[model samples]
Target: MEDQREIAYVESVARGWTMEDGEDLSAMRRALREVRARALPMNMSMDLIRRTAEERWSS
Candidate 1:
């Protein structure tokens, strides 16, 4: 419930950005890349991560 609302709010905020919006998407991609880089060496499967990323953008 609360988590859904928070996620919705974050998505809304992200959608408000244009290509000119500096650093937001870059920072997110960087953070995600860092996390993926670290997790892959530890054998983490990123299927869910990919799905979440796709779902967010496709929404």
Candidate 2:
């Protein structure tokens, strides 16, 4: 259940949407932090993040 929620949050972020009322901001921030941390190891750029978000939204 938590996994599904996290996925939804990621998809929402990818789609360039803001968090709606009652959404978990902390969790979303944590998720983003985790993504950044992971991406850091790969030397991923902000452009890559934007592209990834666009791709996720399109899919």
Candidate 3:
């Protein structure tokens, strides 16, 4: 269901993205590498992106 959307902005951003696409793949991996540096210190969910999503859309 994640692939389905109703908003134009979301559809616009999602239209052409795919992991198989080689566009900016290296930089994307590097950014993910930086994200992987975050540690699960003292009991925390490894879900920083969910927090980012909530912050982005829960206005």
What lDDT score goes with residue 57 in model 1?
A: 89
* Backbone clashes under 3 angstroms, per model: 0, 0, 0
Query: Candidate 1 local accuracy as lDDT?
Result: 0.56
TM-score, each model?
Answer: 0.33, 0.34, 0.34
The per-prediction CA RMSD against the true structure, in angstroms, equals 15.1, 12.3, 11.0
Q: Which is the leading candidate under TM-score?
A: 3
In candidate 2 the C-alpha lDDT for residue 59 amounts to 61
lDDT of each: 0.56, 0.63, 0.56
Total backbone clashes of model 3? 0
Worst 10 residues of 1 by lDDT: 2-11
Q: In model 1, which regions exceed 4 Å deviation?
A: 1-20, 40-59
Candidate 2 lDDT over 1-59, as tens digits, reads 45554333335434755454345777777787998777654445777888899989876
In candidate 1, residue 1 scores what lDDT?
45
Model 2: residues with Cα > 4 Å off, grouped in runs: 1-17, 20-23, 41-59
Per-residue lDDT tens digits for candidate 1, residues 4-53, read 42111133644753332346656666787898777754324577677778
Report the C-alpha lDDT of model 3 over 1-59, residue by residue, as the tens digit.
27753222112554853443344556676677887887464335546667878989898
In model 1, the clashing pairs are: none
In model 1, the Cα lDDT at residue 8 comes to: 15
The alpha-carbon lDDT assigned to residue 19 of candidate 3 equals 49
